[model samples]
Target: MAQPNAQDDFAKLSADLSTLRSDVAKLTETLAAIAKSEGGAAADAITGRLRYGAARAEAAASGLAEEGYAALQDAKARAQALGGDLGATIERNPYGSVLAALGVGFLFGLLSRGR
Candidate 1:
């Protein structure tokens, strides 16, 4: 049996990770936007409590998930600082990054639509 090339395996894994990161960023933006847009007082309070729970979850995440979350938050901050859209990020890296963002947005849309 032939063995897989280690470098190729790593590259594929890295791409998958990048896509996942982008997806999380999109979801974060979508959720934040949704929170801003579709909320009465009760919904606002619920979101606030959910955010509080997120802080606790952050504390519990540990290791790689924590690092991923931190990177996600950084990506989100950068997006918001640049008006929170695709243009800037896409201009920097055309294919992978933008696709990741789209994947994230798609996930967010599906989840939000369900709710």
Candidate 2:
């Protein structure tokens, strides 16, 4: 067979290089597609966790609000009962109540004098 020509070898090399460039382009596109898919999945997982945390926090806040309201109602009832008792005592002994009030005021004044 005749020896291979330099022009023929050059043409073969150019064709091989073109095919390699096309393959590299295809590979880059495939890698980009895979990365996008993975990123989307990660985003979904993070969003799900955030929603779950928010729901838990809302429930805890609602529970705390209910407890605070119940405590306030209890305190109000006790205050009303004490007010009724004090009113009855004062009506039965008006002069004694006035004397006790003056004594308590004097003591309070003495205690707070330093402050």
Off by over 4 Å in 2: none
Candidate 1 lDDT over 1-115, as tens digits, reads: 9899999999999999999999999999999888777766668889999999998887777666878999999999997887746667777788888689899999999988943
The C-alpha TM-scores of every prediction are 0.33, 0.87
Q: Model 2 has how many clashing residue pairs?
A: 0
True-vs-predicted CA distance for residue 59, candidate 2, Å: 1.0
Error of 2 at 115 (Å): 8.0
Could you tell me how far off, in angstroms, the CA of residue 1 lies in candidate 1 after the best superposition? 4.1
| lDDT by residue for model 2 (1-115), tens | 9999999999999999999999999999999999999999999999999999999999999999999999999999999999999999999999999999999999999999985
lDDT of 2: 0.99
Best TM-score goes to which candidate?
2
Candidate whose lDDT is highest: 2
